[model samples]
Target: MAKVRALDPSKTASSLDTPTDLKPDGVAAVSKALNALLADTFALYLKTKNFHWHVSGPHFRDYHLLLDEQADQIFSTTDDIAERVRKIGGTTLRSIGQIASLQRVVDNNAEFVPPVEMLRELMNDNKAFTANLRKAHELCDKHDDVATASLIENWIDATERRTWFLFEASRAGDNSGH
Candidate 1:
């Protein structure tokens, strides 16, 4: 097996290592914020996956594929968020129960919604997720955690793009006159 190269100790912030450079209370606050954002993103990913599986209508094929791709992106981002939390001396809560109890985003019933409605719901979800990520980025900025903030900015930009695409799709049908 190939040996895994470890991240540079100076750059690899361990969940176990106390942040001696910052006030302890500041570290704890940032950790709490990151955990909340991570769980929320996880919940949004599940909702996206559900929509991908159940969406049906005139645009069913395209919407389904898009949702699947978006869900995969969200899943990948969730992993990054969780790992960053762990790197910042905080636990990444992974259990379903933990995510369910801590997630700020609410789950949607994807099976019953119309295709256009699903797009709307997903857009709303992404907007909410973006808002939360922005808040987390602000908190990270307060603590001088530029690494985590940069990661979050990437996620936020991706989510905004996804949301805009979804909303545009929803509007496309309206402009066509039946």
Candidate 2:
């Protein structure tokens, strides 16, 4: 057998080398916030899709289509969030357990939820998600990670749009107060 060689600690796969000038703490800060946001995004995606699959009543087709569209949008965001972490030399979430641990959004496991209730819950979750995204953007700003911040700006706008659509969908005839 060949002689065993000692591994060099500095060049381990767990520690990635970043091309950017961001310090270690900055990377940690940004990565932590982004991962948390990523977890929440995943949670939101699943919940929206759940509502899409289970939605019923007079507006079934409309709500189903809306939730499907929102789910796709939420799912698309996860990749960007994960890639941003890797771009900054930070490892991202690896498993469902990790996502569950990091996610701030609560799961809805009820056997049945009314279509309007589903829309309202999802709208509230999207609103909270917007706030969380804002917080993450603030952290990115603090770390001067402009790339991440710009991505977050787009996400915030998308989330707000989702919230607006859900809110409008969940209300009665005069929901718009027009």
Best by TM-score: 2
Candidate 2 TM-score, C-alpha based: 0.89
Which 10 consecutive positions of candidate 1 have the poorest summed lDDT? 1-10
For residue 112, what is the lDDT in candidate 1? 86
Instruction: Enumerate residue pairs that collide in model 1.
Output: 15-89
Model 2, stretches more than 4 Å misplaced?
A: 1-15, 173-178
Q: Pick the candidate with the highest lDDT.
A: 2
**What digit string (tens of lDDT, one per residue) describes model 1 on residues 1-178?**
2232334577865546643344456567777887788788888888888888888788888888899998888888777777777666666786889888889888885348887888898899889889988898898889887888898889888999999989888885677743
RMSD in Å for model 2: 6.4
Runs in model 1 deviating more than 4 A are 1-15, 18-20, 176-178
- Give the TM-score of each candidate: 0.84, 0.89
